[model samples]
Target chain A: MASTLHDTPERNIPVQRISTTTPMSGVTSHPGLAAWSLGYREWLRFVRQRNRVIGAIGQPVIFWVFLSAGLQESFTAAGTSDVQFLEYFFPGTMMLIVLFTAIFTTISVIEDRREGFMQSVLVAPIPRFSLVAGKLAGGASLAMAQAVVFLALGLIWGMPFPALGLLAGMAFLLICAVALTGLGFILAWRMDSVQGFHAVMSVFLIPMWLLSGAFFPASNPWLAWVMAVNPMTYLMAGFRWLLYLGSEERIAAGTPGLAVSLLVSFAFCAVMFWASCRIAQARVRGDVRS
Target chain B: MRPSPAIVISNISFAYSARQALANLSLDVASGEIFALLGPNGSGKSTLFRLLATLIPLQQGEIDILSISVRTHAVEVRKRLGVVFQSPSVDAKLRVWENIRHQGWLYGLSGRELTTRGQELLAQLGLADRAHDSVETLSGGLRRRLELAKGMLHCPSILLMDEPSTGLDPAARYDFWTYLRQLRDEHGVTVLLTTHLLEEADHADRVAILSEGQIVACGAPEELRKEVGQESIVVHPIPDHAKQLAAGIAQRLNVQTRTIEDEIHVTADDATATIASLLEQFGPMVSELRLGKPTLEDVFVARTGHRFWNRPADGDSLDAKGRANRKGVRNG
Candidate 1:
């Protein structure tokens, strides 16, 4: 490798370098700015890595298309009157996109830790809140962006949805994305390898999504109890209610109220975010191996 | 009065699960000086670097930077520190300018001021032309220059680098050290770097030689080398009679001799006279003879009673343990 310090033509140019005494005057630890930079970096990386875009949005769309098409005749969103599988599964597919995006974005946590980028951030003079908030914001925003694309696709597919209802549904989806991203952050924070996160995704994240009544209605008493305890169920209920608000079939089916669903989703998001912050602040055994 | 030391590490110790990495280590580095922690693999230099960088929490004792306690004022210390890690910390996907911009943001720098500072640093490091290029497109030496540019981007008063010359060619290494010297001399920035290479450590103002988690010797490289002797004579006898030749030479010369691995080392007051006597007395027994001014390696051997690179039982395992610890850090 050639010397970068002395070989260039610019080396002959006499320039006075800034000394440490001045220190880029007025620069200090700004948590908000640091957080914004971190979040923006995630967006930059996402745009550059085309495979990540496809994996997060494309794979989930494929699943939704094939699964809904195959089950359109046999499955009829049991217990809901006159609800077609395509529309009934619309909210679920949107949720799946958010979940996939969460997985893709959060997996970078493990990579950053391994590749030494996290070491730089860990040593920076910023509060742990900035780190956690920045990462969750990035993941949540990416997930929401993908979910919105799916939402647009659903509307174009001719599902009956009012403008006001669709706007409210986007709000609900943003909250859902935040909650799911927080979950991913918590799981990926301590994980050392992407494979370990994948293992966790299959055993924990996928099952959580499956049991949230996104793929099928929880008509069986046992299944209903499971979905009732799952936090994702509230997110799905809140989103589905908003997307189908005032529609004859939705009103007849009678999903959970907006207030109750929002309350539970907000509570879940707070807890997950709080837990991730605690992990980030931990001074022992997490930042480095020993 | 002289300013207080820029870094004060007092009686610090760290250990892995069952193996100790650093024990009761203490040293102080003066401001505007280049201090090197010189050691081979598993000598605890890297562990010390990590603790100082705040990448790992201190296990025991205290480390204060510019009078601020690392335990309580880590963030404040971080503000004063610019660290270049052994591993490449810059994102390869990001353009060179993008990496610098983001680094500035992490330190609360932004907008016009950051752009100007970044540009100035890029020009100084001879990377201005490649500012818009992706980092992955650069060679190892250029990437290292970028790392240096990032470390200095915040205009930190102190710079901490771990194995800064690990992957560089000889010319690049020379350029790197020349720039570091300029930082210390022109900007009055204190530098603390860890290196296993003796030549690299020789460039520091002072070097602390660590062995088995302790500082066996600490001083200027020349002073430490002088402590060994005025000159060093390495006698490599035939393999079959290495032990006998060492004993015979010790008796014949009536001087202290150390037998390390297959060679016998004799620190002599006069190399010319000693070599003549050894050749006359044991010409057929000796296979090779080398005489030179004492080096840091000679100092290390004299202090530790072992070869610098070859270790006893504990050292062999230490290499594996150090590797495993690195893997653990990466895997985690």
Candidate 2:
């Protein structure tokens, strides 16, 4: 009934007040720090979960060895005269590694929500865009790290690894990692559970990878049209061009040109990144599904 | 001049799909006060907490925290608010210090300054020795303390907590309250918390009891209790005749009576006199009777005309006197 009763002096005890003002340094005020901190947290979680790290990398390696070995004997394509299935599937497996790492890293978004950490972050002073960027960066880093390990295996497998080619291929992988992880982040952001995310990945990510010129060349007109629209197709083509720089015979004939592939991959990365930022901003307007 | 109130909520309402959680609710909390939003489950206390903490968007009405609008100036409001959610927010994989440090970073505290503050909070929460341990290794009580440490890492001027003592043991709850009081006393931090527990509400300096998205009673706990009555007299008639006995007592004594299951509850200023008169009038019908001081639970019952813990049965009539009591309390 009393509106101002809580303000009475008798009810308020006299204790030394600690000053509430925080020292404002430019570094602390920068939104980048929030992003960096979030990214660091994600990295710590990833490395500490040994099983996750192993599963993310090992599954792709097993898929590469088994799928290529099983298909090498009977696999034949119109453009390739003497190409081995192992060589043909090498770039696909690299993409697979990136995709696996991306999925593993972005899955934490759902876990964070369940654990209540996302709620705390949502209420903080940091911008929502920074949160998105931080998450993407964290996931992209892990994806790229695993992709590099597989790239090393490509080198050992005698897929012509020129120094410039390796550098270009790493750069391409980085771009692809950012793009794929951003896509995964968008999917995971709207998903409430890991099973839901997996279902979405199966419906969306797997088909995109399959349609990319990963296993067989898109020699047929219909399949080539589908592959032309797939972003991962450019990624696979660009990676193949970079990995076998001097050996044009080893590269698939129908794969897009290096410049065209780079341009498309960059465009895809930019669009995915921008779309993710928009989704994060939309969440501020309370468009959250959960 | 006195400082502005820490929080001002006006005409706020929220709904999840078609089910309304809060409706046209308004309240104020002064700076450096321990204010409790008391209610049973589904009373909209948690909804109000989420709105104040800026965890959820304001769908209708306005809320201001520390002079910043929660709708138009959410980031600024967030800067002044430290929230501990009802669910555990600490990352189980991260060490105690890492969690605190990460929270500090989100509030724009970094470098050596953030580290110092993190250590200070850990030490203050009695978690200095466990700073290096992973959060999963800590017990529930310790984890709760760690959550508090993370919330306070940024030195927020106002702390919003939802069911803060939900999973704590009795001793941990005591320690939690002590820390809340210390924050108010030593640092002048205002605290607003939601609790379904009556004892927790009793410990607050002021409480607002919500029922079905409305504030049924709001004032100092003692004042609210006194407003209802100083004492309550409960009588148990034969199970089948409980409703009849309650109606007869209300008509004869001109006192409000509510029947919850087989028990007839009446609020009286003089319990001994009421009991003596009741025994003389209806001794054969009365099976058991007891007199006790009014509690927060009693206040809720008086204002709502139903048990706080149980939903009123379908098709039950609300007593007119109880409606008047609620109207009178709300009007003042």
Candidate 3:
């Protein structure tokens, strides 16, 4: 190899380690302006993290197939739901899709820190807010997209959907996605290890789904009292009210008020977003005491 | 530009909670020169490098990197500087070319300009052939070379590299430095890097000899050696009582003595007769002897009463690397 390299010395650079000098090619062809571009790049990287978003599609698919099929015999046997059980479950599965996407997005924080990308972000000349907003937007937008796909899947599963119902469902799901992603960031910032995040997820996420009004209506006397206070109940109930019940579902559930649910989600996400920003700032300041 | 200092840290003190890491540490790196911060594992070199990089905030003192105040204008200062951390920074999921291009974009590159410059950089780093390959599949040396490539992608004027040669083969270290020197000479990139290897420091433009949390001496590598003002004398004392014998040598010879691991070191004497006479006088108490010049290692030993490798094992300091490798040979 050295002999060939030495024979063609004039054609090729010398066979020696060389620093990038005299404008090496194949970089971003020009100089960069600022650090907002890092946020964009970070968001691009998040989108390519496939496994995290797959559940957003997969979970809703399973719910549409299994839960809807399981309910046919029950609906026939009890005459419980007037509409098809599959259509009744569509709003619930949409909520589940958001839950899966946003929750898994939290784990990205752990991965970034472990992979050293978090350190890279902290060291750049970007504003702290951009880092927080960028990651949140990246995760939330992807979750919203996955949720949209799930909604389209729900449409194909023999579900009746008015145009207004469909648009309202889409808007509600996006808000839920943005809010849940904020919560995930908070959890990820507080927990350093993947195993720890896993523990929190198993203990917190599936149980929250089981108890909240996603699959079953929270009307079993004592359960209704608990569901009234559950923020996720409000979120799911809002989805139900938007997708199937026209404008009367909130009055029936008594607590899944769209206005109240959106307010609560806004406050929850805002607080979590602020917490993520604080944690990042502390890390940049090198106060890793926590 | 005048040949004033490129960096200055004045009265800097820092700690990790209760553990005091840097105690009023100070140093200067001249413009247009390579300054090596040499110390054993726990000598506080990493902390000092972090302060200069503006990766962490300054708590107690003033720091200036390239005439800009690190605290007052850290972001602006960052624009003038670059850093290659000890840990790898490339995204393993991204291909080699995208990784570089993404970093360039973050700094402001875009459009056809990004494409043209990105190609030129990959070729310059000789990573063009592997441009489409995933970063995880590349060899450690190649990944490290990519990092060095990434650091220079933004064309920052000053660069800080933490253990740039760690885990690299000997030949790779040589190649890495060759490009580094080329960058400095051609593009005037002022470079400050940390290395425990004394031989590596021998080739630096200047060296800062750190022991514990403070810099004991700072100058050109040769100048630091000359500061000791005499050839080094290494002695392995008699029996297991090397401690007592070392004390006696320090007392009688009026020179400093540091028992670094198994060896006892003494300097500041042209002492063929002194050793012969001392061997004759002490007879059975002296076991072995060696002689050398006042290199950075010698300067560190002279000021802190221990060699760089032993600087952290002294119990109060937490130099992580020194503590881990104190039992091995100093150079390793």
Candidate 4:
């Protein structure tokens, strides 16, 4: 049991280069490299954990299919004549896919801290911004990738989205992904349990998405005001407007213009990312509760 | 001039919200030495370990690692320190080499150098063959060895480990210590570890016994035990009469006696002589008697005047409440 590596005759041990006089000095930290490493780790974990992929993509596709089928006959937008409920709900379903992936990816923050992996990352020489950036980038990449798959499915179903519209829709999806993942990071950083995060998702995230005109338009005058104030409303509008870029298709009524929606969505992404970095700065202050 | 110590903790104190975790504790660890912090649960050794690892911020006082201040220069201090936590830090989803490779990126190591260093450390820690295996598939001992490889990947001058032997079996523990000693003797890397097991501390070059957020004793294991007494005598008196028997023995032998649970412990200079007189006087009362050379437990009792595992009154567990009350009375 006490057999030594030095005494193992079968193995050729490398010359022990544990330098004593000259300390290992080439170990310099770069923000970009640090960000890439952390982000890459998230992708590696996501690839290994197959259930997360199924959970993120499967639940939303089920929601889109059933909801569209049930509402197809009765539901109609006030201004649009030919648009069916299935077509009307396509953008929201894509948003749902993005939302689910963000939730799945950012929950790893709490798990890492609990399992002691975050302690090592927090103590690393890299800046806190790198930590925040890497996580958000990885999560956003995952969300955008899943959302694109849903978009392709819609195209194959004869939704007839123009090529220019699809390209513009991808840009909007990336913005929404970054913003949502950043929001998830901010929420997950303070939470100690995944159960708490689930509560937040149900009570806060789901309602916020519902009121953003993703599920249905805010037809009531006061409901319109609430949707106008929601950050997700701008994202939903930007996505809807871009999905009909080169075509004469009438999008859902009452959405803000493309310029205003893009401006507000970009602003929302900046704010969420800023808040995430601020909370991550807590690592330096020792406020990051173990 | 003599080189400064590798780690200098000066008058540091910390609190977790309302509870005081560490008091004005101070200690200096010399270069290339194996120092152990020996304490039981709630002894604040974990708090100290966190502070030195730069995981938690300093509340008061200062800690310097190789002349770099931990409070003001944490990133610098982190660069020179290799920290191994009590819980496993490796990602179970990733292969062993993948875990090391990712860790290497955090420290800015890459390509051939990172691969070479990772291979060297894996071979040295006896995990060369397991490099491609997923961490979740490895046994506890093997997982711990992988953790060591990750910590040493950056070629840190000082290794700070918290309870490195907590879940390991005896054979694995011996192998772990063998690796630690080899690190110190051959590479001149300073090793500071925390443990509750007395045998673990016995293997260290120096041991600091902590109790209730304070250092009770600090010295070599042999010196600490010798300071308590030359020999230890444990006398098991008749059931439910330990207090009375302890008082009788203390007065009869003109020595101090402590009754812990059902046993009365007496540290004597001549245990054979004391046992002879004790049997002649109280053979009918004594159920059993055992003699042994003074151990670290004796030294702990001598300095702290209580058992090592005695928790403070506000500790989380309910089982230690009775002992806590007794300890409070002694302190009061």
Candidate 5:
């Protein structure tokens, strides 16, 4: 791997750092409770501000209403999928919300680098991944919270809820949340400016949002194949699968998509987790700069 | 020194793109001494500081902090290094106590120990009274203090401040320097800071002046002053008349003439002759003139080709305050 731009090749390299060989896991060096406190503090920082709290929950709720209304006519004209636009998209929008939330949370890394918060974290006697993975897990936890509120929104919208699978659906949602945030964290590591970061993430975010059945039910054979390749499609499929558990015919029809999407998303998370660690290590070796 | 250099750097060299930032720069902060890296902008002081704090990896040198290699043993290195960046880091919505506690958690502290240490650090930083207060409400100086406390919450071996005095008012700047002295006298924390203020170096056991991405000079403050000392004269001739005026003054005084900040600055053992010559010959065309002892700017100009604050080259990432972010990979 080429060292980052910060690494001046000809000079005596500092301690050679072999970074990111495996999926960089876990940032909390102090056990579960300690990690919670760290993450909880991060949560409290954003939550105590009532506007931020409302903003977090309100975004997806509003997206559901507006996008559902916009796509209602399309659903009526569609083939025998046997689902309303609102029902089909509830899970997709929830996934999109988690995806966006992860992006927003990860942007904090750029902000922290500007303010010196990152310097404070790096100086602490902890694992290097604490700087990123801790942020990832913390963002995931918050995404999970937002996901629950969104699912509750789905319940109120008259979508057929498979009562027994709600917990399982939530479990899958948390996994998606972790996976999304992990990728966001890795992207955050490479960008130094907010404007540049948002510009690049929007490229990924818009394409993924469009392809993952968030606004449309992803039915075109050619397009569905492409959507099948998008990792987020699995999250939507998994949520839909769980939501339709007691129903007949349409239940788990997308199981292969579900299995494939989830595996791909996990793979993305693994790759990103390792990428973040590599970037962090490169920074430590003076090869990369924030 | 009781706190021995919790950090040691030797022959550190860094660059931004094709330009070098730290050219064979080296320094040591005896544990507990408030070492200050002094220079004007583009002096590579921030790059040196970031390297010592482990913000940037040593590209062409070696750094050992409390016996831990910053490269291979970064985890151990981080355990001892604490950084207070030039910009704000604490989230505005987080309470002061919460920010401090979060830093402790990153260091693997928890429960009572985290809380107690957080409290103690807040108290030590004079932020105890505002522990529950939201960080956004704090003033610039207080926020910086909170940043310092947050950095030190882990009881780091070396505490670093990169232009920590930038945003403070005059009173706060003075008090801030005093508090640094107390950090050593009371807590025995090794301190290394970067500053643009000349008087700021008065407190340093030693000071290094960096310019154009190189350590141009380094020594005790008084020694540096004495070496670069002697009378200095600066002349501002009527629009675009510097060359004519410099030639006139140099010929009379038989000394070196330099142009800095659009003015003809002449330095010699005795500037009396130079000033007299300028007043006699060039004074007719001169618009402004001043004579004084060689300040840090003189010390810098005596070595580097420009004034201390004169930015000759873009060297690092710049914050809103004009401080560099020390991104040696590709700086300004």
Candidate 6:
């Protein structure tokens, strides 16, 4: 189909004569262009695919509404009386949006590898880190966009979205998005099939989300210990605190402090980003696992 | 002083697990030549193409492109080379212009320069009218042309393509070659491609025939054909009698003969004389006979003593005699 963007009436644009005589070493050497182009292409593809945009934002909203409605009467926390199930599930649903968007965006890596695009990119002159960074940045941006939409739903659910708290929440969500997308990139880079990738998400990602105190509070000592060590738990706590910022009643529920949440989320982002770059560099050096 | 060759691959070997894909393969492609790596399936031409394109690592030797070493100077080598893989590499969701634009950015071209270059390549490849169309909607031939345009977007001095005609129809293949020749003649870009089609290889300035991970023949098409013989005489004996007739012909005429399917092939300097005598000797036993000028296919058979088209299927066990013959062929 003809693209709506470039379908303007044809004009006689003078064709500039490209000089092929430039020495190989003297060609323009802007390495960052590769990363920008890759990120931009991903953004373009994501926006054009209407179903992807819908599913990333729609599925989580549906999940949050249905799951909270089903569990609202039976759910209770030991430390708080004012926190309802829907209010408690809000941040988790935002996280779910981030997770789905991240997973959906990074899944293209496997398809790219299969369709020969990855091979072409790999053989290009740009540094390997640029490719990894581009994918992580692209996936993270999409994840954050969807997360912001889910976050806006907090107002309709009667949770106050204070300005500073919303800013902090946005920053926190961005960090989480980058970390989750980078993690997905690492997994997708090594996987040969999307089916194998889905199996991994089911076995690893869903459990990580469940244990992050999203569905239930970490009140028991053993479950608290697990949540204390879970990186996502800190993100969930940070998100909840941001959502219920001005209310002391919800704050008394004892989510982790803001500083600790930001620190752990940043650390997780840095670690995942580094790991993704390492995997991409290994592939560049011909250590492809597949 | 002679100009340096465009590509020089020396003594490179590669294997997947224990099965060797390429072994001690060495060849030189002169600058501005249209070179073809010719082979049947699993003959390692594709593997060799990957090695030259730097898609795979060199295990045993060196490949130099325009005097730059592929192993040590891979980034520089990549800068000078453009590669078109056999599979479709264009993103289906992106427009043709966007596909080339992204490829240009990979080589550090951007802004006005990238846009103008993309337009120029689209014009050169006869895709200017469809530049805004989504790649998924294009035919296989147009997609392939878009791939070529993408590969050449950075103005690479040397272009490497793996089976560039794999999915193209006959007319499309002809058009593709026309563009390739234009690239070489007008811009002096060296073109290297791998193909199993004998006619495709015949169109190249030079052809390197690979068999069992080794080169069995390398030369211009006419030269390789001349080396095989001036003419090839194929005799069709009745069914179930080819092997006996081949053996009889070898014994009676003392010429090298090989049985392929239900026919016996004998290469001769004068096909008329050979056919006349064979018919006189065998008479009614000969079902049919044909004489034709030696083709690249004949050159392959002459060099490898096996038909190019009917390679034994993978995992088929070789009898002891076939094994020994293959070993002798390899050693010799």
**Clash list (residue pairs), candidate 1:** none
- The positional error of residue B319 in candidate 1, measured at the CA in angstroms, is 16
lDDT by residue for model 6 (A9-55), tens: 33222222334543233255456888888888889899889999888
DockQ of 5: 0.20
Tens-place lDDT digits, model 2, residues B101-156:
88877888877888877776676677888999999899988898888887887778
Alpha-carbon shift of residue B249 in model 2 (angstroms): 2.8
- List candidate 2 stretches off by more than 4 Å: A1-29, A75-82, A283-290, B1-3, B251-254, B311-332
Each prediction's fraction of true contacts recovered: 0.43, 0.40, 0.22, 0.44, 0.37, 0.37
TM-score of each: 0.92, 0.90, 0.83, 0.90, 0.79, 0.90
Tens digit of lDDT per residue, candidate 2, span A1-290? Answer: 22121222332212222234443122224478889989999889998899998998898889889998899898764566877788788788888888888888888888888767888888888888789889989988888888888888878877656788778878888899999989998888767789999998899998999888887888789999999999899988998888767766777678888999999999999998888888766543222222
DockQ value of candidate 2: 0.34
Lowest summed lDDT over 10 consecutive residues: which window, candidate 3 chain A? A1-10
Report iRMS (Å) of candidate 4: 6.6
How many pairs collide in each candidate, listed in order? 0, 0, 26, 0, 6, 0
Tell me how far the alpha carbon of residue A57 in candidate 5 is from the true structure, in angstroms, after superposition: 3.5
**Model 6 CA deviation exceeding 4 Å by range:** A1-26, A76-78, A242-249, A252-254, A284-290, B1-3, B311-332
Candidate 5, overall lDDT? 0.68
In the order shown, the candidates' Cα RMSDs to the true structure are 6.4, 6.7, 6.1, 5.7, 10.8, 7.6
Label model 6 with its docking quality class: acceptable
Q: For model 5, give the TM-score of chain B.
A: 0.83
Predicted candidate 5 versus true structure: per-residue lDDT over A40-65, tens digit per residue: 76587567767666777788788778
Compare candidates 3 and 6 on lDDT and give the better one: 6
**Model 2 RMSD vs true structure:** 6.7
B1-332 per-residue lDDT for model 1 (tens digits) = 43579999999999988899999999999999999998888899989998998888888999999889998888998999999988888888889999999899999988888898899888878789999998889998889989988888888888999889867766667667778888888878899999877667878999999999999999988899788888778887876989888888889987778998887888778778877888888878888777666777778888898866775365332222222211110100
Chain B of candidate 1 achieves a TM-score of: 0.92
Over the stretch A1-290, how does candidate 1's per-residue lDDT look in tens digits?
Answer: 22332333333323345444444322488999888988888999999999898888888788878888998888766556667777777788889988888888899888888777888888888998899889888988988888888878877888788888888888878888888988998888888889999999999899899887688777678888888888998888888878776763563243456688889999998999899899887654546542
Ranking by DockQ: 1, 4, 2, 6, 3, 5
